[model samples]
Target: MELAKRIQPTMTRQEQEQRDRKAASNRQLTALLGKIAIYVVTTTLAIIFIAPWAWMVSASFQPIGDIFDWPPSWIPENFTLNNYTRFFEEANIGRLVLNSTLVAGSVVIAQLFLNSLAAYTFAKRRFPGRNLLFVIMLGALMIPGQVNLIPAYLILQHVPLAGGNDILGNGGHGWLDSYAGLIVPSLSSIYGIFLLRQYMKSIPDDLIDAAKIDGAGHFRIYWQIVLPLCGPALAAMSIFTFTYHWNDFFWPLILITSESLRTLQLGLALFVVRNRTVWDIVMAGSVIATLPILVIFLLFQRYFIRGISLTGMRG
Candidate 1:
């Protein structure tokens, strides 16, 4: 009886401890499972986002025949540079690239300078009707570019005094189908000005006052002090401006008629001119056109990220 009682008590205590340990293990297991689920969900989302780009890269290398084969392949079985070669040789794609680069570069430079200046004035300077002017500028953002396309085209076509036209909006060659037509309308971007203005407002007033006290003129303060500190915002605006101009199709399609003056985006459209389209060549041209932007982003990725983050901070 003594042996039985002693053994039973010890067994009961051991069983209880074992049960507690198992409960603790179960709690740990639950936490681990939650973390694993979160990780899986995150990875799945990343794959979804990356899959399209991966497909594009794969498609660019794929042979024409294999592109539409049963059960789409992720990897190109027979990779060839023939598409790229054909694009460059047949389409004069190099010239198209040059045109895009020139237009995008000019837009970026002009927009950055003008927008930054306007933004600085709105943010720091005291002037009559400043608030009212800013409100008006903000309101311009609501005006769709499509709504003004017809009027803008007409104005360009009838621009007086410069294109050898009289003030009556007639008898001039008109800027239509020219580089000037392509660029002039986009010179002053209201959104760029607004973005820069918001960013500039975050700067402390004391810095401007101190700079002014040090005999810095308005232009000097803007050029020397303000511009340097606005690297993030400027970088962001540059990327946006560059990308927009580079990829712009509708405006160039409407304005530029000459094959030689065609931008990269417009040049790519020429592939579909025939009743039957060459998917391989078309995709190849697309790949080429997209590469430059990708390269640019990769090269300036740090600035792009900084710009985005900086802009978000103010918002």
Candidate 2:
């Protein structure tokens, strides 16, 4: 009887251990299945988003006829460089690229400087009505940009002492059809200021105080200390600013008239011949127009992601 008792207890212990092992294995399997599901969903989403761009790139290489083939070939049937060569030959691509580069670069630099300065003041300096001002600025974001277009046009068009305007701002196309028109209005972006402000708020106040103790002026501290630390945020703002201004069609269409002043987006519109659309030329131009932004984004992607995340964490 004692022998049987001992044997029964041993068997029970073995069964319990087996059950524990089975439970662990089941948990591991469930976790693995969940991971696979997540990967599958993400991969599907990536493909869906990337397919259009892939088609665009593929079509850019194919002949116009192949681009419109019944089945819509993803791969080029007759690969040719005619589209690109024709685009470069027909369009003053060099001038368009220069104009766009000039405008976008100017806007990025100005916004970085002006917005960061305003952001630093709003973030660190204590003054009355600061919060109210910031609220007003944020509120401006809610207002559609189109709503301000007319007002901006009127203001720029009649600016006193600009573009041959008299004291009353009523003369020779104040800022119309000029680089000034394109670059000036975009000098300070409210969204850029807000982004930089949020990021700057995360910086320790103690650093600013230390700089002051050493007799560093506000400008010195802002330039030497705060600006360096805000590199990621600035990088993000630059990319956004550059991309927006570079691709902006409506504003330039309204503001610019001279062929010399036409931006890349405006130049692309030229591809739309009177009634018919030149799909091949459009594709080629799009590929060209997209390259700079793509390069810029790829280079600053790390900073852009980090800036967006950290800026939101504190504010």
Candidate 3:
């Protein structure tokens, strides 16, 4: 009886260990399955997002006939530059690219300068009604840009001393069909100012004070000290401004009348008009237009994220 009791306790101990091992094995399997499911779901989502761009890139190389194949080819069976060749031949693609680069480039440069300066002033300086002014500026963000289009158009149309407008701004078309019209109204970017302001506030005040102690003027301090420190913010703003302006269709469509002055977005519209649509050539143009933005984002992605992170932090 004593021997049997001792053997029974040993058996119970072994059973407990077996149960523990089995439970641990079951947990590991469950965890592995969960991880696999997560990876599969995320990978599927990635493919879904990437498919359109992949198709766009693939279709750009496809001949016009192959573009409409029943199953929709993800990879071109045979590649040809005919779509690209036709794009260049039929459209002023080079000129359109030039126009887009020029306009987007100019806006980026001007916005960097103007927005950084305004941001520095708002962040570091104390002036009368400063908070009120800033609040009003932020309030503008709540209003839809489309809502201000008419007012902006009227203002641009009636500007004095340029575009042949008299003192009353009631003569020739003020900046109409000109680069000035395209660029001027865009120069005062409240969003850019706000973005830069948040970033600049994070900069240490000691640096600005030290510069002031050296008898540096506000412009000198702003240019030499503050501006250089704002590289990441500037890059982020430049990319955003460039991308937005590059893809701007409505503003350019409304303002620009001459075909030669048309931006890339407007020029691409010539593909799908009245009765005809050229899918292959249109896809090629899309790829061309999209390539710059992708390249810019890839190059400056880190800086862009850093700038956004800095903006979220307090001074």
Candidate 4:
């Protein structure tokens, strides 16, 4: 009887140990399955988004005859440079690229300076109606840009002593068909101000105070200290501003009528319309148009990500 009692206790301990091992194995299995599921979902999403661009790139190289073949080959059977060569041959690519670069660059630089300045004031300065004004500005974002489009155009059209307009703000085309018209309306963005304001709020007030103590004026402090510290945010804004203006179509189409001042997007649209039947060449143009955006993103990606991550941390 004594031996049986001792044996029973030993059996119970062994059974408990077995149960614990089984439970641990089950947990590990469940965790592995969860990881696999997450990977599968992520990979599927990546492929879905990347497939269209991959196909477009492939189609850009395929011969014109092979572009619409059955089964939709991802790899071209007949690779040719004819489409790209023909694209340059038929379009004023250099002029279009130059116009796009100029417009986008101007907008990016102007937005960075103007928006950051406004953002600094909103963030660091104390003034009456500051919050109210900020809220009003943010409210503008909720309003559809289309709602303000006509008003903006009219304002630009009637500027006194500019673009052949009289003091009464009516006489000629005003800003219509001019670079000033294309650029001025986009010089400052409410969204940009909001973004930079949020980011700037993360900056310590001690720095600004110290700069003032050292006899630095607001602009001097902003130009020397604040601007350098806001590199990440500035990079983010530059990428955003450049991309938007570079790919802009509707605004430019409505604002510009002169062929000489036409942007890349405008030229691309005309190219598409003119070569509706030649899809391969169209794809080549698209590829070229997309390159600048890719380059800009690649150059600023690290800063952009850091800026976005830190933007709302304090505010």
Candidate 5:
């Protein structure tokens, strides 16, 4: 009887151990399956997102015939750099690139300065009719750029002070087809001002107070204190402005009639005129045009994220 009692207790302990091991195994299996499912879903989404860019890169290297082949070859049997070569050599792509760089660069600089200055005033300064002025500026954001296009063009055409327009606004040398015409009008972006103002408002009042106590003027406080803290917002605005101006097609197409003055987007459109579309060349040019943006994003991606985070905090 004693032996049987001891044996029963040992058997029970073994059984309990077995049960615990089984439970642990089941839990591990369940966790592994969940991880695998998550990985599969994430990989699928990544592939879907990357597929178009992959196809673009592949098509850019494909031979002229393979580009429009019936089956749509994803992998080219004969890859060549002829498209790129032709782009640089025959198409005067360098000049188009220069035009894009100059226009985008100038717009970025001008918008940054103007928008930041305006935002500082809106955020920090106590001026007469300030709220009314800000409301008017905000209202401008609601007006579509297209609606103002004609009026803006007319204004540029009759710019009174510069461009040789007399006070009477007659027979003046209009800024049509000029870089200044393309740039100056775009400089006053209400969205940029609003974004910067939102960011500026989030900054602690103590910092500005300290600067003021130190005998700093509005300009010093702005340039030294506010602007440094606004790096992320400024970067975000810079990216937005640069990309918008760089990819601007309609406005440039309307304002710039001279081929030499044509931006890259406009110049690329000239490649496909009246039903003659060279798909390979067009895609190649698109790839080229896309490179700058890609480079910019990669370089400023950290700043961009920081900007977004700061903007969200303000909101």
Candidate 6:
């Protein structure tokens, strides 16, 4: 009886400890399940978002006939560089790439400089109608881009003595069919200015004041004090600007009539005109067009993430 009683008490204590550990484990699992679910869901959505582009890349390696196989195959059974071969063979891919690079690069560089300057002015400098002007610019973002297209096209079309026009901008194509048209309209961006301005407001006033006390002029203060501090914002804006103009179809299409001047996206569209069923080459060109931007994104992703977070918080 004494042995039985001692053994029973020891067993009960062990069982109690086991129960407590299980309860604690269950609670942890329940909390962890919520986080795990979120991770799973977000990861799934990321994959879904990437699937089409992934498929496009995969199909680019496959033959034209195999693109629409019974089951969509990411890995091609018979891989060939024919699509890339045909891309170069059919289109002036080299010239198109050069044009796109020139256009996108110019836009990115110019927009960063001009917009940063304007944003700094808006954020730091005292000026008349500053707030009103900013509001107007914000409103511009709301307006459909197409709303101003006709007027912009008319201006380029009618500019004097440019393409072949007389003194009245009526002799020839003004900026139309030229690099000026492609770059000029895209250089100024209201959205970029706003993004930078919002991000700049987060910077403390003492920094600028300290610079001012150090005998820095407005421009110098801006260049030295503000620009370096806003690197993340600038990087993010550059990415957006580069990507937007790189993939721009409608504006470049309207401006560039020459195949030599056609951007990569425009040249790729020509493939659709030539053959709807020939998606392999189209996808090949797409992948080519996508690579630089993708690489750029990967490189600047950290800056982009920080910029976006800060801009969102302040704006």
| Whole-model lDDT values for every prediction | 0.84, 0.87, 0.85, 0.87, 0.85, 0.88
Range of the 10 consecutive residues with the lowest summed lDDT in candidate 1 = 1-10
Worst 10 residues of 4 by lDDT: 306-315
- Candidate 1 per-residue lDDT, tens place, 236-296, comes to 8999889989999999999888888899999888666751457767778888889988988
User: Which residue pairs come into collision in candidate 4?
Assistant: none
lDDT of 3 by residue, 1-315 (tens): 346446667567667677668878999999999999999999999999999989999999998789899899888998988888888988889999999898888888888888888888899898998999999988888998789898888887888877789988989678777788888777758888888888788789999899999999889988999889888788878878888999999888888888888899888875557216688888888898888988988999897777667655532
User: Which prediction has more favorable TM-score, 1 or 5?
Assistant: 1
List model 5 lDDT by residue over 163-263, tens digit each.
67787665765787889888888876887888899889989999999999999999999999999999888999999889889998998888888888889
Residue 195 deviation, candidate 1, in Å? 1.6
Error of 4 at 72 (Å): 1.1
Which pairs clash in model 3? none
Q: Which predicted model would earn the best TM-score? A: 3
By lDDT, who's the top model here?
6
Residue 252, candidate 6: alpha-carbon lDDT: 86
Q: Of 2 and 6, which scores higher on lDDT? A: 6
Candidate 6 residue 178 C-alpha distance from true site, Å: 1.3
Q: What local lDDT does model 5 show for residue 21?
A: 82
Give a tens-digit lDDT track for model 2, residues 49-155. Answer: 99999887888888888888888999888998888988888778998999999999999999999999999999999899999999998888899888999999998
Residue 212 lDDT (model 5): 93
List the candidates' TM-scores in order: 0.88, 0.88, 0.90, 0.89, 0.86, 0.88
Q: How high a TM-score does candidate 6 get?
A: 0.88
Pick the winner on TM-score between candidates 3 and 6. 3
TM-score of 4: 0.89
RMSD of 2: 4.1
Candidate 1: segments with Cα more than 4 A from true spot:
1-20, 161-168, 273-276, 309-315
